[model samples]
Target: MSDAPTTTESNPYLRDPDVQLMLRAKAGDDAAFSELVANYQSRLVSILSNLVYSQETAEDLAQDVFMRIYRSKNGYQPTAKFSTWMFRIANNLASNARRSAGRRKEVQMAGGDSSGVQTGNAGEYLVKEKSALMPARQLDKSEMQGIVLSAMEGLNERQKMAVLLHKFEDMSYADIAETMELTVPAVKSLLTRARENLRTQLESYFK
Candidate 1:
């Protein structure tokens, strides 16, 4: 009659559907593995594209992420949301790529899209406070998108990653902290500074 909760009871992420799919993947279910890939491929590519600033590079990195996941399937653990685990891999890969490259450069978006990512709700999030940033005049969608992309570029790598996870993934601060391997408070501070930096950059465009 112990009152303590079991591991599964304690970790609610274990109940996530993606985690169940991954568990099946770990059990050598080929279809399950494919399903996981299908589920996350676009999201992975989109996030990676923004991180690396190149569509081609993003695609390659995304493939690498899947490969890594496949190879590590036997050891898969449901410690967090599957997306959080996946993005942790992505964040590391992007950081390593940047370190090896040793320079930042602008790359054109695929299909003329600003920010070079799927950017789910990110544009909307950016303009939620539009009045403050563009007091002089109203910007059309294209113009606002370009400014948002530029503002995103102003952030450092960590801040950009945090913001992307927050806005695009709609991840909680706790999940983001785990994905980024930072404390919760640190993630909060990082996101706060990221928003401030973005606001400053966007305001400069109107000024």
Candidate 2:
């Protein structure tokens, strides 16, 4: 009997449709590549915008991510889900950008738009349990969104990234650990600390 594992056993992530698409792209299927880009472009931009706090910079970084993916297509492997692999690339790029730019100033969430990043359910995700503590005066959507954005901005970089992945992407701790190149326990710790920080910030609003 052969000692080598079967293909599916060796790379279970190959079962993912996106991973199939990526494999097709690696085989020089341009349409498959375009589909991957179309599917993930906005999502990448949204995540990067939250990380860098600039729509323009996020869009630019997203393009760079795709370009790197294209350049490395021949070397692509299906050991992880496509999104996990892509976000791992994004995490590294965002870290590099942050380091190159030094300290970043906080930007307020603009009116009429949440700065091109959807705050979808983030408020609920962060503070649903504390809803009863809120003041009797109901907060409008924009006001609550601003509060959430400020709380997100208050998190340190890794914590912010971990929270975004957990809430926005619905990634589990193991997936988050793979994306961020951290151990699962470390990812859990980051999220635990992030939730506490967010709770503290939200409590101030409730007060």
Candidate 3:
């Protein structure tokens, strides 16, 4: 079947066929590749922006991530949805970024994170509940963004990945497992622990 997705359609977002686009990318479709980039670049930027904190650094890191994706296109496999696989790569890159910073502090001096911004009487976890309702429900975009990033910074890398892909992206357990290379049960366990920890971090906000 040629293993390539034909990009006859101008806006794949209307089609929303990521798997098709990825297959096309695997088959060396530059237009398909550009479509993939256009669809995910902003999302990648938002995620990395929160993790890295510096806008400039996030941009560079995002570019590197896409470069990695480009490099990996030849070997791309559709084990999970394109989004899940992409986020797995993203989570890995973000963690490496933290490590590469060489700023190891005993969880006591996690700077620039600021433990997230409090919008109101809601605790950190509670604020998340509200943010989850709608992108433009009752909060400003920047405020919601800060909360998401700060909350993520506090989570363990694995937990953060699980939460980000699931809570933010609404991925399924099966998909998350495949993307993270964990068993389905393992992803569930990770989510459970992640929720608990976030709730704890958020408890202070409510208090």
Quick one: best lDDT, which candidate? Answer: 2
User: lDDT for each of the candidates?
Assistant: 0.77, 0.79, 0.67
Q: Which pairs of residues have clashing backbones in candidate 2?
A: none
In candidate 3, clashing pairs total 2
Put down candidate 2 lDDT per residue, 75-151, tens digits, no spaces. Answer: 78777789999999999988988765542212332323223232223344335423544454645755676578778
Using all chains and alpha carbons, the TM-scores for the candidates as numbered come to: 0.76, 0.78, 0.64
Residue range 3-68, candidate 3, lDDT tens digits: 333353643422448877877887879899899889988877766655555545666777887888
User: Of models 2 and 3, which has the larger lDDT?
Assistant: 2
Model 1 alpha-carbon drift over 4 Å, by segment: 1-7, 103-140, 204-207
Residue 191 in model 3: lDDT: 93
Looking at model 2, residue 99 earns an lDDT score of 66
Put down candidate 1 lDDT per residue, 83-113, tens digits, no spaces.
Answer: 8889999999888877655432233322332
Clashes of 2: 0
Per-candidate RMSD, Å: 8.9, 8.5, 8.6
Task: Quote the positional error of residue 36 for candidate 1 in Å.
Answer: 0.8
- Sort the predicted structures by TM-score, highest score first: 2, 1, 3
